[model samples]
Target: MSLKSTVIFLLSLITVMAKAQIDTAKIKSYADQVMVRVNIDTNIERYVFTEGPEDKPLETILSINNKTRASFSVDYKIISGTVSFTPNFLPGNNDNELKGSSSYADFRFRFFPKKIIQTVYYKKVKGFYIENMQDFFPEWKEGKDAYLQFPDLKIQSFGGSTAYVMKKDFSLKSIYTQGEWQKESRGSWVPVIDYDLSIFTDIIDGRKNRDTQYSIGASMGYFYNWVLGKKNRVNIAPNVGLGLGGMFSSTRDILDDGTKSSKENTQYLTIRFATGLHIGYNTDRLLFGGKFNVTSSAYNEKGNQNVQNNNLYGLIYIGYRFPPPGVVKRNYDKIQKKIPIL
Candidate 1:
C-alpha cells in the first residue's frame, strides 16, 4: 500500500480502539499528568557493503562523523512526541578535521491506544565517510590518515510501525515512554508491522544520482519487564525481534552531459533483527533510565553482493511528570472530542 493509505488505515484502527479500557490492576496509568524528558545519546548509523566470494570478501563501511545527539520529549495522555538533533559541540561530535562534517535530524511521534502502539518518524542524514579505510589501505593510520568522504551523499526516510500486545497484563508503555508503571513482572509476545519509504541522493563522478526504496516487514517480538525494589519503582526490560521483508528500489542517474538516464527498478529480500535492554527507576513524580539498542537489516544484491544497515545507540534520560495546566487540558479535551484518536 501507499504511505498515505497506510497512515489512514493506522489512524482508523487507533480511532476504533481509543475507547477501549486498560487493565488497571497490573499497571498504573498516568494519563492525567504531562511528562517532559531530556535525553542524551550516542546513536551511530552505519552501512556496510560486502562483495566477492564468501571466503574472501571486500567490505566498505560508510558512516557519519557526528556521534552524539540530544532530544527533548513530551508526553500527555496517550500521545508522545520527540525531536532530536546532532550536537556538534559535544566531545566526539566535532571531529571534522579527521572526518567530514555531517548533519542529522529526527522527529518522532507515538500513540498508545489500549493494547496497540503506533509510531511515526522522519529522519534525515547527510555526509558520510569511509570508516574502515585501513581495511582497504594497509598503510592508512587511524588518527593520521584522511578517510574518503562523500560530502554530497544524503539519506531521508519516512517510516512508522504498528504493534500489538498479546498479554493484557504486560505494559509496554512502562518501558517505552514511561507513561505507565507496571506493578509486577510480566512478559508479552508483541507482533509488529512496519513500513518505510527512503530516498538516497549522492553525487558521483560529477553526476547526480538518486535512489528511492520502499519496504514493509512483519515481526514477532518478545518483551519482558522485570519489576524489582521494595516499592516496585525499579524495572528491567529486554526485548528482541526477528523479521523478513522486501525492498523495492528505483534509481535515476544524471549524465555528465546534463541528460537524465532512465529509471532502473530492482527488488531484494531483506532480513532484519532488533534487540534492546532498558533499565529505569521510576517514582511518583520523577523517572531516570538508560537503554541500549541495536537494529540491523541485510539484503543481497546482484553479483554476490550483500549490504547491511546497522543502527546502534545508547541513551540516558531523565523525566518529570506533573499535572497538565487547566488551559492545556481543556484544549486537548476539546480536540480529542473531534478526533477521538488523539
Candidate 2:
C-alpha cells in the first residue's frame, strides 16, 4: 500500500475502536451499576452511577446540586449496598404523595446552611414600667402611707446586636443599648430632712431628673424555621431567648441639706426573657427580614430598696443577611446531634 493509504487505514481503525468503547459504555446493565434513587411526591428520579466509592462529601455535592434545581428536599438512606435519597425533590413536575397539615410542604426543599452565619441588627425599644409608683417611694405618702399616685414613666432606647449562629438551630448574641426616660407630667417627690423633720420635697419644677441608662447583655437561643413557597423563597423563624446582665444609670437623689443632690451613678442587676418573631424573603445570596420581639426584665430597684423594678420592652427591627463562607459548611445530616462551643 502507498504511504497516504496506510495512514488513512490507521486513522479509520482508531475511529472504529473509539466508537466501540462509547457503545460499550452506553449499554452497561442497570444491575451492574450502583444507583441514587430519589422519590418525591410519588415520582421517582434515579441517578445511575459510574465509578469510585458511593460516599461523597454532602456539602460540596449539595452546593453543586443546588445550582441547577431551585426547589428540592434531602433525605438519604443506604440499604443493602444501595445509596438512595428517599423522598428527594426535583424541579419539574413530580407526583404529590404525602398529604397532611404541616410546615413540611413549606420546607419541601430543605436548604439548610452548614456555615457560620453572622448577623448585625439594629433595634428600637420602647420600655414600659410595670411597678406601681407607690412601690417606688412609700415615704412620700402623707400620714397613713396610703397610695401616692405618680405618672407612668416612659423609656425610649435604641441598640445594636451582633449574633453568631453556631449551628442550624442555635445561636449566641451580644447587645449594647442606651436610653433616657421621657419627662413625666408631674415632678417626683422626695422625703427630705428639714429642721430635723422629714417633709415632702419636689425634685423638679415640673418633670424630675430624666434618668439616663446604658446596658450590655449576652443571650443565647434556638430557632425553629419554616420555609414557605413552592420555590422556598420565603422563610419564617420564631425564637425564644433568656438573658442576664446589668444596667448602669445616673440618677437623682436627695442630700441631708434637703436640696437636690448631684446625679449618682448606680448599677442594677437585670434578668431578661425575650421572644422574637422573624418574617422574611431570601434568595441564595441575599436575605431581608423584619423582626419583632418582646423582652421583660426584673431589676433591683434603687428608689425603694424593698421593691423591684418590673420593666417590659417591645422592640422592632429590620435587617438583611449576606452570603456566608463555604469553607465552614458541614453536612448536618451526619452531625445534627453534635454540640459546639458557643
Candidate 3:
C-alpha cells in the first residue's frame, strides 16, 4: 500500500479501538498536573559496514566522539515534548583532537490519545571516526594512534511512529513518560507502524555527494510492567519488537570533472529490531528512573555489502509534578476547546 493509505488506515484503526473501556482501578492518571524532567543519557549512534565472505568478513564501525547528552522534557495532559543536545563539558565527550569534532541534536514530541500512542522526532548528527582502528591497522594503539575521521559527513533524519495497546489494563505511559502509574503488574502486545526519511551528505576529494532514504515498517511488540514495593512505587518494564521493511534510496555524486551523476529509487530489504528495559520509582509528586534501550536496522546492497545502523543508550532521569498555574491551565483549556486533541 502507499504510505498515505497506510497512515490513514492506522489512524482509523486507532480511533475505532480507542472507544473501548479501560480499567481505571489498575492505573493512575496525572493529567491534572504538569511534569518537568531533566535527563542525563549516554546515547551513541553508530554505523557498521561489512563485506566479503560469511566465514571471514571485513568490517568498519563509524561513530561520533560525543558520549554524553542532556535533555529537558515537559508533559501536560496528553502532550509531551523533549529537547536534547550533546554536552561537550562532560568527561569523555570532548576528545576532538583524535576523533575530530562532532555535533548532535534531537527534538521529540509525543501524544497519548486513549490507547494509542503517537510520536514524532527529528535528529541531526555530524562527524564520525572509525572506532575500531586496530582492525585495519595492525600496529595501531588505542591512545597513541588516531583513527580515520569523516568530519564532513552529516546525517539528518525525520521519523514517527503510531502504536496501539491491545490490553485495557496495561499502561505504556507509566513506563515511557511517567505520565501515569500502574498499580498492578500487567503485560500487553502492541502493534506499531513507523516511518522515516533520512538524508546523508559527505565530501570526498573536494566533491560533495548526497544520499536520501525512505523506509516504513510494521512491528509487533510485547511489553510487561512489573510493579513492586508495598506502595506500588517501584516498577520494572521490559519490551521487545521485531519488524521487516523496505528502503528506497537515491544517490547523487559529483564526478571528477564537476558533473553530477544521479542514481534514483534503488530498493533494498530491511530488518529491524528493538528492545528496552525501564526501572523507576514513582509517587504523586516525584519520580526518578533509569532505562536502557537498543535499536538496530540492517540492509544488504549489491556485491554482498551489508550496512547496519545501531543505536544504544542508557538514561537516568528525575522529575517533579506540580499543579499548573491558573493562566497556563486557562490558556491550555482555550486551545483545547478549538483542537479537542490537546
Mind giving the per-residue lDDT tens digits that candidate 1 earns over 63-157? Answer: 99988999999999999999998877788988888898999999999999889999999999999999999998999999998889999999999
RMSD of 2: 31.5
What is the lDDT for 116 in model 1?
Answer: 95
lDDT minimum window of 10 residues, candidate 1:
13-22
What stretches of model 2 exceed 4 Å from their correct place?
1-158, 168-208, 253-260, 280-292, 302-342
Candidate 1, after superposition: displacement of residue 27 in Å? Answer: 0.3
lDDT, candidate 3, 1-342, per-residue tens: 863564455445434434432445389999889999999999889999999999999999999988799999999999999999887788889788889898999999999998999999999999999998999999998878787999999999999999999988888999889999999877778999999999999999898999999999888887778778999899987777779998999999988898889686699989987778899999999999999998889999889899999999999999999999999899999999999877
Model 3 misplaced regions, further than 4 Å: 1-25, 255-259
Could you tally the backbone clashes for each prediction?
A: 0, 2, 0
Best by lDDT: 1
lDDT of 2 by residue, 40-120 (tens): 222111111122333631111100111111222122211111111222244422222211111111111111122222222
* Poorest lDDT segment (10 consecutive residues) of candidate 3: 13-22
lDDT against the true structure, per candidate, is 0.90, 0.32, 0.89
Cα lDDT of model 2 overall?
0.32
